[model samples]
Target: MLQPPGALPIRVLVVEDNRDICDNIAAYLEKHNFILDFAYDGISAMHLAVTHAFDVIVLDLTLPGMDGLHFCQKLRTEAKLQTPLLMLTARDTLDDKIKGFEVGADDYLVKPFALQELHVRLHALFKRSNGKAENVLTVGDLTLNKSTLQVHRSGQRIDITPTCMKLLQRLMEVSPSVVTRDTLETLLWADEQPDGDALRSHMYKLRQAIDRSFEQPLIHTVHRIGYRIAEDM
Candidate 1:
């Protein structure tokens, strides 16, 4: 199978109850330069899938506690995650596969499949998910190129610090949606957090860089809630 197009590793979440299957897939995919995260059951998988971003999700249909169908439904509807999901199941019936797609599975793979086939399918799914957009993130005229780390607004190039860029990327990724202060803090510092409004200080620097010169002011504070990148829709 071909490696995903990029210098960064392809992040994959494999949600399978079968230990043997998980090990087998991990051994092969890891050799082929793919980063994999595993969850034995659906409940923990749901938490991982919602909280973390992955290039593709390889999910088995029969899972304990939550089951793949319900997990997929909640991931799509409740979490609003558009990550590509591929279902692995022994059920070969058309109805079973249809149910998988109806619940927002991007592709289906039957059990006892070859490891090579799974790799190929996953690469394809990742390509399809990232098609056309080509690693460029945009909120209004502000564009941040993932590959280049370049930011531009209103046809003018804007210089952004790496720290500010991280904050900008998160806000733009979920544009128009309030991203809580807690969430941003977790993303920025993880467990070894800085004390006393360090996040607010960085946010202030970011705002001055991205919004001070622009008239339309895209970044908005939600007033005790968090921040968002939007143009007042």
Candidate 2:
């Protein structure tokens, strides 16, 4: 499905062998509300990559089992998955970057990197995946224009925050499927999933902005599960 920009918080698989670095990345990402999954070796990375869907992957060059280059090749050649890859390596050379790209890496970051830069790079990777622009979104009088992040109901435009827009977009895209609270929080917060009642508060705000003003409520609570947007509602 074509998820709107920021519709889901970027899911990142951190494939690094260094325990310290892996923990650091996980901590940083969690602080940002990203649902971070980890793999310390190339084989495991490949397995996770193939089995689960990720918005972007942060791969290390020196991984156990298969190396990053080989893993990238396998992903492109064998798996045929085009998920964006951000390569991380201690080998900061022109040839290294070139080789990574030659395989299938969408972007590269040399080790001893800044946390901020990694964040920016991940953002860039996913934005590029979506052609880096907001256009229009349709989900059964409910229409959204991504460029402006605006929603419409039967031609009536409604103003919404970027967060609400994202929530609605995801719900609409996966209509009828229960979106778990964790999943929705992961999509909205990214590495920064909230604790306590914060997520519930956001959902309330989103419902108020979109569904409260309309008839035939599109957003529905799934009872002990999460939430879903019903086009038929």
**Which candidate gets the maximum TM-score versus the true structure?**
1
lDDT of 2 by residue, 1-233 (tens): 22354566779999999999988887776766468899989988877876567889999999899999999998787555678999999999999999999999999998899987887788778878868433676766688775667788888878877677667776765566666776666566655556686777777887887678777777788788888877763
Give the per-residue lDDT digits (tens) of candidate 1, residues 29-53. 9988789999999988987775577
- Each model's C-alpha lDDT? 0.86, 0.79
- Model 2: number of backbone collisions: 10
In the order shown, the candidates' Cα RMSDs to the true structure are 3.4, 10.7
- Kindly report the root-mean-square deviation of model 1 from the true structure over all alpha carbons: 3.4
- Give the total clashing residue pairs for model 1: 0
Question: Model 2: residues >4 Å from true position, as ranges?
Answer: 1-7, 132-233
